[model samples]
Target: MTGPTELPVPDTVDVRSGPEVSDQLLSLLPLLGEWHGEGVMTGTAAGSAQDVRFGQWMRFSHDGRGFLAYESRTWRLTDEGRIVGPDVRETGFWRPRGDDDVELLTASPEGLVEIYVGRARTTTSWELTSDVVARTPDAADVTRAVRLYGLVEGALMYAIDRAGADDPLRPTMSARLERLR
Candidate 1:
């Protein structure tokens, strides 16, 4: 005898037809989808010495649970709009506490793991400050970070500010992505 191959409780991008989303996650309802867009990346992070254009795809999905699984992948784009190669990739989860607080846990390919806690500023906006920025022995000297995500008009907009060993917090990346479906 064999069991089903499909996930017992699969994550769903289509909220209307997915396992009834828990009311606990309703505060984050607007962010349920896959988004793709281009954004500018600039900083002192090695390859980011100059302003670089990057394309990003982010998904926020739930599996009939209280948290939403998240993933983001970005690729570098030449000024001429050519895809050079991959840039940064990360995956994590978003959990809402009660009615207003939120927690985001993410792990990056660069050996960094972040735990951010914040709250819903409005029905369409959230601001998070890192409670911890842990990294492996070879990771960048990231000390702390903050991120803000919002829905403007019909687009998903986000920005991240980070501080390293001797670096002050500054804008690292910001983007506006459109829902694919």
Candidate 2:
């Protein structure tokens, strides 16, 4: 005759908190809208004097989780007005990491692994540094890049500084973006 049976309990228990989202991530709602910008990229296979027209659009969405997913598409044109080989698309996630920092995780087909830390500078400005890792060995890579985004003269302006390169005088890219709203 069976006297008694014991049920074993699992080691871990799942807890639900009805979508715990961060306030910092919610502040990025304004960036969700459409943005148009024109810029030029130099230091390609061509010489430094070559110019290209650039246009980019960034969008943000949520997937019922605490993280906000973002995608950015950019196109480059030749100096003679010819389309480049392919458009660049970067897919990533933005989420609050700690008290005063945000984390950005992204992956690209060009063997780019990116992780950025965001810090708020002012009410409408922020600074970010992306740690980039290359999947290939021969790529001229940068360990990290410091980027500042702010409004100057009613136009969106950005500056980038790349560090951890083999060369100290490596060329950097800088552009000013006018908000085409």
Candidate 3:
């Protein structure tokens, strides 16, 4: 059997910072596209003997709505840049509140959900802090997290700082991704 030909209101995948998107989403429009790149992770953070690398694909889409849909998937890479295995996957939404306030809701298949709130620091930069982090019984221990995303030199670059119950917040992972669209 075949499924339907299309969604009733299919998501639009290639909207730039224009009037098509909600006014609240203007500050986030630059991120609306597919991004791919590789980055290094601390040994301790990667649960490995030493620092490791990973490749990631991230996307931001919209349906001419008030929020943006977000998703990210990553895979582990070898020293020679070959895929080893899966690393992380996340799905979420970005809700721009009022004019400048932003709220990000994200979840991982590993059973962790995080709610973040912040504001656009610049036309191309955003800083978010974790307001809540909930996990299942088997999930990893996460106490706090912060993220900074910036459009730097024509690339989408981001860094995450995280901490556990017993650990202090520190830089964890960062990547410079180029838009594929």
lDDT of all predictions, in order shown? 0.91, 0.57, 0.89
Global Cα lDDT for candidate 2: 0.57
- What's model 1's lDDT at 158? 95
C-alpha TM-score for every candidate: 0.94, 0.65, 0.94
Give me the candidate number with maximum TM-score: 1
In model 3, the worst 10-residue window by lDDT is 10-19
TM-score for predicted model 2 compared with the true structure: 0.65
Maximum-lDDT candidate: 1
Model 1 C-alpha lDDT per residue in residues 1-181, reported as the tens digit of each score: 9888887667898887769899999889899999999998875653556888889999999988899899999998999989999998999999999789999999998999999999999999999999999999999889999999999999999998899989999888899999996
lDDT of 1: 0.91
Q: Residue 13 CA error for candidate 1 (Å)?
A: 0.8
Arranged by lDDT, best first: 1, 3, 2
**Over the stretch 25-65, how does candidate 3's per-residue lDDT look in tens digits?**
78888888899998888787788888889999999988888
User: In model 2, which runs have C-alpha deviations exceeding 4 angstroms?
Assistant: 1-24, 44-51, 80-82, 131-134, 151-157, 169-171, 174-181
Deviation (Å) of 64 in candidate 1: 0.6
Worst ten in a row by lDDT for model 2: 9-18
**lDDT, candidate 2, at 114:** 70
Can you tell me which runs of candidate 3 are displaced by over 4 Å? 16-19
Displacement of residue 42 (Cα, Å) in model 1 is 1.0
